[model samples]
Target: MRTWNDSLKIGIPLLDCQHEQLLDQMDQLLEAMESQKGEQELRAIMGFLKMYINNHFNYEESCMALYKCPVACNNKDAHAKFLITLQDINHKIELKQSLELIVTQVKQELLDWFVNHIKSIDTRLQSYVKKSE
Candidate 1:
């Protein structure tokens, strides 16, 4: 199960909720792959995951902008790279690439990025919020 530990909190309620939803989608994808789900079901999930991520990332970054987070631009670039990588993942899935490899690679990369971004970059934004208040 994906976690929503306190350390992941960025003091933004909406962003935190979206983060939980994204993690839940990731968990569902992992479970589906482990069970060898069919293409149709996977496609449904991919559709939701793609749109949800796009929406979440865009909105969260906009929050940073409103807060005048200095790291917002840098964070947005990282988000862009992630979106590009997600597109590549979609391509690989469409081509029937090894599900195990794809799941492992994607999950690990995602978790690593989440941890690093939350611990370093997101925390910087939190500090900015604190300082601004």
Candidate 2:
């Protein structure tokens, strides 16, 4: 599981803190999934994310727009894709899918996507973040 670190910072404190919280949550979720205590924990984490992620995305998107960042559209697109993935995960849970499948899905869809988004896509915001500061 990936832990939050300074290397992940986008040069914005609020967004960086939100990203840290998300990384921490993802780590907890992954740990729980690995330990076979996933179902309840997954539900809780999903519930939390359902609320938190939207706010985070909105703030990030707004910043992108305000700064006229070149990656604004890509960031919005990625966020939409992530929301769909989250819905798909919830659907699978509702269908009583195997925990193993859910774990694989989360790892592939959520964890990997998030890390890559940060390192690649979101990193494009660094210049803007610096300018804002």
Candidate 3:
């Protein structure tokens, strides 16, 4: 179970905290799924993640645009795509897909995409912020 650490920080305290919380929630979602927790619990975590991700992405996108970060366009496109993927996952859940399938998708799509996005695009944003500062 991967956990948040300083290495994931993009030099923005608010976004960093949001990222940490997102990662923590992802872990809990995975744990609950693997432990065979109830559907209600899973839905609760999913609901929080859905809302939090939107807020986080909006703030991040605005910051990137305000800072004139080079990756701003890419960041926006990525966020849009992620939102679509999340919507698909939610649809699957509503359709009552198997828990194992949902877990796999969450791990592969949400968790993996998030870490990669942070390491690659968000790191570039951090560099821009540093230069601007």
Candidate scoring better on lDDT of 1 and 3: 3
Which residue segments of model 2 deviate by more than 4 Å?
Answer: none
Ranking by lDDT: 3, 2, 1
Q: What is the lDDT of residue 99 in candidate 1?
A: 95
Q: State how far residue 129 of model 3 sits from its true place (Å).
A: 1.5
Model 3 Cα shift for residue 69 (angstroms): 0.3
**Per-residue C-alpha lDDT of model 1 across residues 54-121, encoded as one tens digit per residue:** 99888879878988998999999989988887788788889999999988867777656666777777
lDDT of each: 0.80, 0.84, 0.89
Considering every candidate listed, which one attains the maximal lDDT? 3
Query: Per-residue lDDT tens digits of candidate 3, residues 24-115?
Result: 99889889889988889888988999999999999999999988898999999999999999888878877878979988998999898999
lDDT of 2 at 92: 83
Candidate 1, residue 89: lDDT: 77
